[model samples]
Target: RDLCADFECEPAEFNGAANHVHLLVNLPPKVALSRLVNSLKRVSSRRMRTEFPEPARHYYRANTLWSDFSFAGSVGGTPISVLRQYIEQHNRPV
Candidate 1:
């Protein structure tokens, strides 16, 4: 979305249900995973609360809409086909 584009990142894939989101992104080499995740959560949460009042009501008083922690793995040297297959087979059902 706008935030991703603004950060010079492209979200290549996204899928999720009610309570979670999965994003596969291609980010500029200058962006660190920690910073990128923090920005996404912070900016998106702010936008959500401001622009979507009704849904924002469900958010807790804490200044957060997503969990503070995230899971990440290095994909170095891994083929896309192999990675996708592993993710689809073992991760999709999660």
Candidate 2:
């Protein structure tokens, strides 16, 4: 979706648990990590509120959804296959 159009990266895998979501994306070289995270949070928050107004109203009080803090890391030096396997294994069932 937006990730594909905006960053030229499609999410390879996605999983969500109680308090967090895990996404595996293949990012283009020019994309900045912080910018990507901010855009994702902003866009998804807005879209979620608009598309699911009842749920958004029940859960959130403000216009924003995500917290200000985020965690990010580079996958450099790790084999892609191994990383994919790791991400696949760690996901919690919905």
lDDT of each prediction vs. the true structure?
A: 0.70, 0.76
lDDT of 1 at 34: 77
Residue range 52-74, candidate 2, lDDT tens digits: 88877776655567767888777
In terms of TM-score, the best-performing candidate is 2
Clash-forming residue pairs, model 1: none
**What are the TM-scores, per candidate, against the unseen true structure?**
0.69, 0.78
Candidate 2: list runs displaced more than 4 Å. Answer: 90-94
What's the CA error at residue 67 for candidate 1, in Å?
Answer: 1.7
On the 0 to 100 scale, the lDDT of residue 68 in model 1 is 71
